[model samples]
Target: MMYAAGLAGVAVTMLLILIRVLLGPTVYDRILGINLFGTKTVLVIALLAFLGGRTDYLDLALTYALINFIGTVAVLKFMQYGDLGWAGDVEDDSDV
Candidate 1:
């Protein structure tokens, strides 16, 4: 019973995040919402695994987490530089 309630709460939170993603005024806001949604998805998968007594879901959740992090970083990098490759023309001061 408690597990069900917790899952329901997480579901509700995801729904709220979805709404924010749709209605967010800025690109950054939407991106942040997406990142949050991904985190919640991992939690949901973990919770489901625990409730079902299956350990395989944990593997899936970990894979998803890695993918989510890479995807988020890629999106943010693309948003900032308009491409995935680092701009060679830009000088790095840290190397100096």
Candidate 2:
């Protein structure tokens, strides 16, 4: 029962994020929507693990959350620099 409720919540969040993503005024707004969706997914995963009686799944959820954070950071950096290889004011030894 609890698990069902969690799934419902996740569905609701996804719908809301989709709406925001569609109506977003800027790229940043859409990126925010995507970030929110990722967070909601992590919660849903944790809830599913609890429902399935698998504590180990919670660890997996955490791992995914970390990955999501790293991915988001990378995306934001790329967006700001217009390239993933940006190294602001820093020169690599190989460049010398």
Candidate 3:
């Protein structure tokens, strides 16, 4: 019962985040919402796996986590630099 409740809560939160992704005023807000939604999806998958007593779901969840991380980083990088090339040397102003 607890797992079910937790899953439900995560689902609701993901749905709310989806709404934010749709209604967000800025690209950054949408990107943040997508990142949050991906995190919640990982939680939901893990909860469902526990509730179902299936260990295989964990593998899927792990794969999803990796993909989500890569996707978020790629999107954020593209948003920041308009490209994915790592050849450009970024000067850190913090060092100044």
Candidate 4:
């Protein structure tokens, strides 16, 4: 029915995002693709839960979204600072 068609569309979108992730020209582009893929995954899980009449799956989807957000932030931070634990203090290069 309509739900099945919606699922198919989402699947196609996810496939496209995967291609972007694989063929992205830059690291940031790949990272953006990954973030988008995660978002689509969340949507897919939510739709599946609705299709199955399972409320618990909605909770699972929310948890996955939280993890995705945290993971994306950690990765971007690591990419920018070269360390996940970097403090926000600017290094004094004048002593060199």
lDDT tens digits by residue: candidate 4, 1-96: 666778899999999999989998898989999999988888899889888889689998898889999878998899878998887567766655
- Deviation from native of the Cα of residue 56 in model 3, angstroms: 1.9
TM-score of 1: 0.86
Residue 54 CA error for candidate 1 (Å)? 1.2
- Choose 1 or 3, whichever is better by lDDT: 3
Per residue, candidate 3 scores C-alpha lDDT tens digits across 7-92 of 99999999999999999989999999999998898999999999999969998889888898888888888987899986456666
In model 3, which runs have C-alpha deviations exceeding 4 angstroms?
Answer: 93-96
lDDT comparing candidate 3 with the true structure: 0.90
User: Which is the better candidate, 1 or 4, if ranked by TM-score?
Assistant: 4
Q: Write down the lDDT that model 4 would get.
A: 0.88
TM-score of each: 0.86, 0.80, 0.88, 0.87
Evaluation by TM-score, superior candidate among 3 and 4:
3
**Root-mean-square deviation (CA) per prediction:** 2.8, 5.4, 1.9, 4.9
Which candidate leads the pack in TM-score?
3
- RMSD, model 1, all Cα superposed? 2.8
Residue-level lDDT for 50 in candidate 4 = 83
The CA lDDT at 70 in model 4 is 89
Q: Which has the better lDDT: candidate 1, or candidate 4? A: 1
Output candidate 4 Cα RMSD.
4.9
Candidate with top lDDT is 3
Q: Candidate 1, residues 1-96: lDDT per residue as tens digits?
A: 676788899999999999999999898889999999999999899889988989799998898888998888988889878899886455656764
Higher-scoring candidate on TM-score, 1 or 3: 3
lDDT of 2 by residue, 1-96 (tens): 978897898989899998998999898998899888888888888988988889789987898788888778888988878888877655545663
